[model samples]
Target: MKAQSTAHRVSRTLLFHVFTAACGLLMVYPILWLAGSSLKGPSEIWRKVYSLFPEHPTLENYINGWKGFGGVSFTVYYRNSLVYTVLATAFTIVSSAVVAFGFARIRFKGKNFLFACMLVTMMIPPQILIIPQYIVFSKLGWVNTYLPLIVPRLFGQAFFIFMFVQFMRGIPLELDEAAQIDGCSRGRIFWSVHLPLMKPALFTGSIFSFYWTWNDFFAPLIYLNNPKRYTLSVALRSFSDPSGLTDWGAIFAMSFLSLIPVIVLFIAFQRFLVQGIATTGLKG
Candidate 1:
């Protein structure tokens, strides 16, 4: 019986490792392929497609991709994306955390009802609201500008608010009482006491906001009419040419480059990020 149990455990461990390795390879292959393709010349990309290593590697694609075809520079698009993403993400974190704190801590009439309504709003598809939002922004002459991207985040987002609220609920009310007894005001209690405790949740929210805003294509596409206002996602679209001059190598290089910021953000906050997600589910 002991021998059988040991054999069963070993078999399970082996199976788990096999599954993990397979999944890791599957996730990594596309990134590897893109990196290899980015180094290849246009002719080498199409002609020697099956080869994992480029026969003749070159950095010309990166140079050209950054510069432009005729008058469409990717550097401008990258700058626009960085600006919009940073501001929008910062606004989202602050607004969402404040709103979440109120929902979780403050006593108010219709608080439960309002929270219910907010949850229902989360269930509703964002696509349905885009048309109305576009109409309003257009009427206000905000199209072709960054306002459309940044302004909406100031009002507080539902998902981040929900995540923050859940995390705040997991923290004990005793902390608030202790702060209050020490003559701390509500603002100070939140800023000095609760805010430090919320580091994990804040890191998680900021990372999500950064990634989503950085990679958002639809919002930029609808609001930005000018090539100069394009985000990386939107800029990638410009690479598709019907004139047979589209540089797939450069497109792949820039696409991979676009992913680096999100990766760095994740790696930097990996510790807090893991804890945040775990604790979010600990409360109602």
Candidate 2:
């Protein structure tokens, strides 16, 4: 009976692993395909559409893609992307944390009403705000500049605010009290006491902000017209021309390269992401 039970448990575990492996492969196949296609010769890209790996595996695509169009190379676009991504991400997370800390810990008049208003902003579609925002930026002479992309994030993002507030509430109030007894002000308590403990949520928010800002195409497209100022997302779109030929291999190569930062970030900080979501909004 013991022998039979051991055999059954081993078989069940093996079956489970096989099922999960299959699901993981299905999800990862597109990325695998993109990597494979990026190595193929331009002609071979379309000729062998279903091939998993390139026959020749030439680096020609990477070479051409790096050269970019105009006088500007892809490195310039990468720099632009990095600037926008890093600045916007920092602003978003910091602002969200500060705003969330206030909403969670501070009690003042009209707080509930203000919280409700912030919640309502999240439900409004971003497309609705685009025209009005564009006009305002244009009037300020901020169009075709990085200011439009970077400045708006100085204000806290609604989604991150809510997430941080929920995460903050889960922290013990005892810490705040202890810090107060030690002659720490609210700012000091937040900085020295709570900030370190809020690592999981902060890391999670930073990762999210990085991903969203790095991949954002719509805002960059609307605000930026200069080729030199274009981000990777916007610059990649320029590779296609309806009136002429498009370089599929270069597109694939750059596209895959652009995904690298996001992938690396997730792999590095995914533990925090999981922990942040898991522990948020529950009292000890």
Candidate 3:
């Protein structure tokens, strides 16, 4: 019986490995292909279309892509993206946490109703409001500025608020009560107890915000007019040739570079992100 059980386990393991390998290849093949294409020379790119590997690999594409021709450099666009992403993420974490705490812990009139309204807001498609938001920003003369990108974050985003509230609800109310019994105020309880316990949720929220703002194209294209103010997403559009030829190699290289920040962020906060989501929504 034991021998038969061991054989069954081995068969399952082998099957799992095969399934995992197939999935990994499906996901990684495109990235590998893009990287392979980026190393190929112009002649190799055109002539060796059927080949999976490049005939001649060179760094010339990366050099030209980084320095650019005229106007703004890739470095400048990267800096712009970094700045917007960091600021927006920071504001989102802080504002969303505060609002979530109010909804979860503090008792105010119509609190449940208001929280329900906030949740409903998250269900609404953002595409529906783009026209109204654009008109509002234009009316305020903020169309050509970063204000449109950064200002809304300070008002507490709906999705982040919901995430925070859900996480906060899982924390024991006894902790807040205990703090109150010790002469601590509501603000102190939140700052000292809830906030520290919510590191994972905060990290997750911030990472999501960073990715969203960094990859955003439409907002930046509509609000930013100057070449210097362009993010990496917008700057990539300029890589197209005058005669309609696209520099696929340069685009892939720049895209690979753009992914570095997000990769670093994930590596740094991965532990916190996992812990936060796991602990959150455990019990009221």
TM-score of each: 0.88, 0.91, 0.87
lDDT of 2 by residue, 78-156 (tens): 9999999999999999999999999998898999999999989988998999999999999999999999888889999
Candidate 1 residue lDDT tens string, 1-284 = 99999999999999999999999988888877888888888789999776668988998778877875448787887788899988998999999988998999999999999999998897898799999999999999999988988998999999889998888898999999998999999889889988899987787788877878888998888888788777888877776555657677778788777888877887787776667557665221
Candidate 1 segments whose C-alpha is farther than 4 A from its true place: 1-19, 241-244, 268-284
Provide the overall lDDT of each model, using Cα atoms, as 2-decimal numbers. 0.84, 0.89, 0.82
Q: Which stretches of candidate 2 lie over 4 Å from their true place?
A: 1-12, 276-284
lDDT of 2: 0.89
Which candidate order results from sorting by TM-score in descending order?
2, 1, 3
lDDT of 2 at 195: 84
Candidate 3, residues 80-116: lDDT per residue as tens digits? 9989889988998899999999999988999989988
Pairs with steric clashes in candidate 1? none
Using lDDT as the measure, what is the rank order of every candidate, best first? 2, 1, 3
